[model samples]
Target: MSTQPAAERETVLIRSARDVTELVNSGAARGSHAKMIVLLALGGIFLDAYDLTSLAYGITQIREEFGLSPAGAGAVTASISVGAILGAWLGGVLVDRLGRYRVFMADMLFFVVSAIGCALAPNAEVLIVFRFLMGIGVGMDIPVAMAFLAEFSRLRGKGSKGSRTASWSPAWYVATSGCYLVILALYFLLPDSQHDLLWRFTVGFGAVPAIVILLVRNKYMNESPSWAANQGDLERAARILRDSYGVDAVVAEDAERPKRESKPRASLHQFRTLFARRFRPRTFQALAVALAQTFSYNAVAYGLPIIIASLLGQGDLNTISASLVLNLVFAVTGGLLGMRLANSAGAWRMTFWGFAVQLTALVVLAVIGDPSSTAWVLLALFALGGFMFAQGGGPGANFMNFASLSYPTELRGTGIGFNQGTLRVGSTLSLFFFPVLSASFGTGVFWVIAAAPLLGMVALLAKRWEPVGYDADAVEHEYQQRLATPEPARG
Candidate 1:
């Protein structure tokens, strides 16, 4: 060995997976390649939000075309959530077993095929089937996308892993706004007689973005270096570190290689690992935030158009314009703010405050009942906007923070998958029941929705777990160290 001091070594020596994890946690500045990887991951999230919302404005048109009852419409709307439930569960496992790059690439095809299928469906049955397929893509994409965001980022800084993961919220809001913009454009662009085809066009357009993401994925995306190291491929991890993260790392000549697993195993035991003693509090906190956030968000954001038109008594054009503005202005802005403050204010604090604001907004909307005057309508709209603002910045963005940062690379996929899968159940219920409940009790539905945020607050108070500024991956590092060290010889 050269007698050079460690600091004078030409390349940083990566001896084990712990070295790789520490390097990643060091928060070194990665160049544009890292940025592109993050962008691609965010692109997946954008597609997810876009595909889910594409039919939001067109739900009525679809109901009219199929001559469906509220229950049928609910089924059509909830199909994707149902599909997502399975997709998240399966995708979580696949992402861990198959690697992030492969699973991320595979999910885009689901988007492409499902979008086309939904676009071309001849009946409600076909639409529901295709929507369910699309939902699977949405569900699968989130875990891998979030994994990419977290794994690619540093542990602490202005744009740390927590902040970067929170970016999914703004990306989601941007996509939701993009859907509305498309609808607005199509509303005027389509001939008066061809207006009925708007939903088809909107749903079909999702395929374009999906295809674009798929094509560019191979060029920019790579297996996460940290993940590769954890899988016992230190050489591959070093190369990734050099290429993707601008770290001049090389596996030490005398470094011990990790024992590779015979196969990538994903099983029920992996799922159960999330509920292990050390992770139980994190699991419960993440689940609470996810369930509450998705339930309330799906109820409000998905039903915004309906609320504007049916409950708020706005015309179609006004409803579209208003929904678009609320998302772009309040939701997008709030998400950006949340992303910015994630490192400063912390995910736990932001999420609690966000739930507080959402509760207040829902209560206000509930009390307003029917807006008898323009002022009351404006107040109700303000309340809606406030809720969106809170969600965009708080739970909407930071839910991912809790889920993604609460585990190491080994369990990250499973943790996020479980959280998302369970939350989608709430999503399914909210989407399925919103129309029925709204129809039955009018604005009283807001009272029911208010409970979601309250539950989130309660969970937060009970758990007191804060993922921000915490090194969850340290657990894996410690475990690896223990394994590498020989056990003390028994006397």
Candidate 2:
């Protein structure tokens, strides 16, 4: 018997985590369980953000310390991005196959070891290896965190979970600004005499946050009821609900319902299932958005400060301060706009407009080329600002939303993983190529960067499904129904 429902209505039999999920989704249950899970997720995201941007802050210092060339610099910088691609792929399989708890806590160790390794590297080769290791932790964290948040958060017409997921985008902004702040503080505190150690400190500082996430996650985490349900363990699902959320659930008396079908088997051919027609569209849509968003973001947004510094012939110190302020304003404004507009503007609409804005900005930047005059520099800055605002609010906010909403819990981790993995692939390619091309092409690099969003537009054109406020259970059920019903053979 249901604790609250027993007195009011006939007690509904509890099923898998799916049933518990319905309770939470229906507002029948509410408590610290969901909120705490979101906190744990946020902590992971915070570190994910921190580790990403911290490298850029120290790029120049690392370059000089190791006597590296641009090619070497790109390789060292992109090492983490490449590692993330691998980690994300593994996370997709691991989180879904091994339970979220196992993968979630274990990856933090990668961050600690990699951070320390980067800080203490004897040579560029060692730094690259460690960065690659750290990248794996960063890559694995997103799918695990996103899947957990998607499964657990209370969402109604774009509720906390969606907000929490959207909050992940701003983590980039937070990371960018935080790195700058750290770098600035270090510069002032250490004086010119000790500034040589700045890069090491910045790279190492990320461990503090990763350790915090690992610690808090220890106390507040819960096994996902939905994931439990997906595994067909109804009792464990019910117990988790009652124990963690205080929702007393009972097994249903009868197994008959008007249109019930068995839950999909927890099969291991995740990649194959994804390509099946029923799921292919959803997979493509999520993957497209992720690839485009990362391509645009890494190509322009991540490297913006470096580009600016190069144009002005400003030293690392000035670049840090300038990019930091720019990112703070951009992050707050764009991230706020994305959150405020998520429900009203809708996701696909934002994605469309985001790509358009980035494309326009890139074109303008190309035309302006490297900023020789003050006027040209300001104009290019304005264009960059437009791209950032549009991206943070649009694709940046919506890509992960699409990834989170695309599939059922059974494949959700893998689904998000594919999105994230492909995302890092795009990011890694962009990060690697952007500098090489930038050096060769100067402002023409914007023209090249502009091409990514154009491809994103092609992906968006492939199909349009706006999933901002839709329930994951309902979405999954709808897919199941389609799978149940036979369709006419196509000519």
Candidate 3:
């Protein structure tokens, strides 16, 4: 059963379900481990948000300094998202192969190194390269954090209930807004001659959270017990639950969990398993939703500062700061709404309505507003930020669930990874194209951009099914049974 010798001590008892209930509801469950995991997981998101917003704020300054054309500026802007696409794919594979804790730790280390590299870059080329490297860390961390959040949040902590995984990512946005606030404060404090260091300091400050979390990771972090269970090490899984979160999960006497028939253990095989017929619908759903949302969100929501600065006909830092503050307010509100609905309405439902509302708001903005005129621009941004709240709260919650539910426990990280990876791809495309589109199409670009989520709404309405109340084990069992005994073809 346990690979360790019989004489080795067990960390916590794994006797019964009642003990699990007790442990999950206990004070310790909320105090150290849960809080630590959530805070650590948010680190990458904070960096991602801060970098995008700060870079957007500094874009005009950077472009003038580097003598960059709009296209050249866009390239620097798009670099991180491009790198994130590759990083998410690589990180997903590594997480499935090396284990979640290891890959997560490695990702944080990458952030620290990348942040310093980004700060020290001498030119646009070097900045792009460094930003891409930083993106790799950003890409990998989102899905891993989701996986961590899904597992950690499930154990009904004090007043914390079922699968409110969406709330997890939004916490990082709060951290992100904090970064923007810091940068804004620095702008007010420093003289105009020192502007170059402003962006550098913002990027540099991102690594602090990562370093702080990495140091304490081993002291409190726990591996996913469900993931261990999927690997057939029920005893080890049980041990993790008991020791890490103080949960008392029962391990069978044999100390091995049952496996799906013909399950594959290799990483490549695990990747393929995600696309198995049983999983294809959900996989597609995850991909579509992740892709559409990133395209829309980054193009508009994170792009708010730039959009607002342009409309105001003012290049002042104060203008950008005010817009960002508004965006953060909506983001937090959206996150709270999504967290509240994630369990009650079902992930797909929340995601669908969220996207629908976002689309409606975007269309309203396109219909009533003009970017070239300063008068209506602030109103457009308010609508943009308001819609963003739904996006973050609604789809933000949904993506974690989508990532977590689209595969068996053994490959949960892969599911989350691939979905986030797909989102990064979409974000990269938006990053590269949105500027071109906006420059060429002007106000018409908003209307055209709204189509992405309209398609998402259609996709969800056509194919999405409820997963909230569905037990993972039951789904796997029934899916396997249907596969084994095919029904005769009807004439």
Candidate 4:
């Protein structure tokens, strides 16, 4: 080793796009930077969870106000997700083409504006339109935000223990818990006199937080180092590492001849390369995880307040509010533990066990199928709690983590966005179909929900892939090399 410090050595240099990640993975040195990325991702997801979950609590009131039929109500609820599918695909393209920080600011503005529009809407039609608009923002945020977190996670130093991508689990649980808490408070504070206005206020309340997030983001947000380097701006990437992430990266004189250990930059056509035979299976794994998690969770978790009201007796707000509180507590608790465990055990382990927990819950609910019985109702609540606990720690949090982390930096945004798009498909399906199914089948609806997790389990067993400690650049490079050779690549 040279006697001079790496930072002071004039000959030191960044050779490839991976150099950005190498420095970032330096751990605590990237604390404020990583924290900022985490906070941004957390805020974006929080707004999404709040906006998406808040509607569940308000739908009854909203239905009453708009005189909606079951089909209409379902359509309205699913509309946001419908818009999200398109937004996610488009957002991924934009982030890769335009930039992360640019898309980040614009998406928040979408949420802020749509929240206001939803609050002031005079009819169900108008509210649905705005919610759809808001969904675009929600959809767009995931790819960039998750990409930001995954890229910043850096695999070196302290972060070597657990990927920074793990922060998303706890952040999302906080958002869900926060939504329940806010809804609970709204229920208590608003009297019967203001019952009709309650949903509007609660939904619109999201705007204030969005504004606060905007302010913090304006001053602090910076482009992803890997992205900058990928765009052939190594100097800017180095500055970002040193200034924003506390990494003192220095470019060696022989940067043109990169150290053999450094991963070379990938071509710009990386997004198109995702569908190749080698990557197709991994893509399927990501889609399966996202779709399964969203479809199952949206059916029960999003509709918990309504489910609680119906099970415990519908007239009193206290019972509904209490159930919401309890459900969120369990979810947040489970999410925190899962977040901790995912870092240590890997996301694949969490997803496998998570499905197992949900499977048991669904089966028990199916067997004890009488909501009329007090004991059965209580058991249902316990089962619900158990399922949420597993979800928070397992697939709910890791779906995006895997999507964002599994791909090369060039394709990370597109990969996560693709996952979000699939998630929206599941969300729209469940949100639209669940109310109708529940109306006809009652708690028997859970037997169907159970099928989603079961499929996830089967896929996991058959595919047998894991992303923990994955090497995105090397993996992509290896795939490319295999393609160049005569034979196909195989494990």
Best by lDDT: 1
Pull out the clashing pairs in model 3: 166-397
Candidate closest to the true structure, highest TM-score? 1
Cα lDDT listed for each candidate: 0.91, 0.77, 0.69, 0.76
Give the per-residue lDDT of model 4 (tens digit) for 39-150: 7767887888788877787887888889998889898889889889988988887777677889988998999999999989999889999999988998898888877777
lDDT of 4 at 482: 84
The digit string of per-residue lDDT tens for model 1 on 100-140 reads 99999999999999999999999999999999999999999
Instruction: Give the per-residue lDDT digits (tens) of candidate 2, residues 184-291.
Output: 899888879778898889889888877877777755777787777666666666666665566666666552222213544334578778888767887888887888
Candidate scoring better on TM-score of 1 and 2: 1
Stretches of model 2 off by over 4 angstroms after superposition: 1-13, 158-161, 250-268, 478-491
Candidate 3: minimum summed lDDT over ten consecutive residues — where?
16-25
lDDT of 3 by residue, 240-308 (tens): 765665444456453323463444653777678788877888888878877777788888865666666
Give Cα distance to truth, residue 25, candidate 1, Å. 1.6
Q: How many backbone overlaps does candidate 2 show?
A: 4
* Clashes (N, CA, C under 3 Å) per candidate: 0, 4, 1, 6
**What TM-score, computed on C-alpha atoms, does each candidate reach?**
0.96, 0.90, 0.86, 0.90
Q: Candidate 2 — which pairs collide?
A: 13-251, 13-252, 14-250, 17-229
- What value of lDDT does candidate 4 attain over all alpha carbons? 0.76
Off by over 4 Å in 1: 1-10, 262-264, 479-491
In Å, residue 287's CA in model 1 sits off its true spot by 0.3
Q: Which lDDT value does model 3 have at 278?
A: 77
User: In model 4, how large is the Cα lDDT of residue 437?
Assistant: 85
lDDT of 1: 0.91
Candidate 4 Cα outliers beyond 4 Å, as residue runs:
1-12, 26-29, 156-163, 252-254, 257-271, 311-316, 478-491
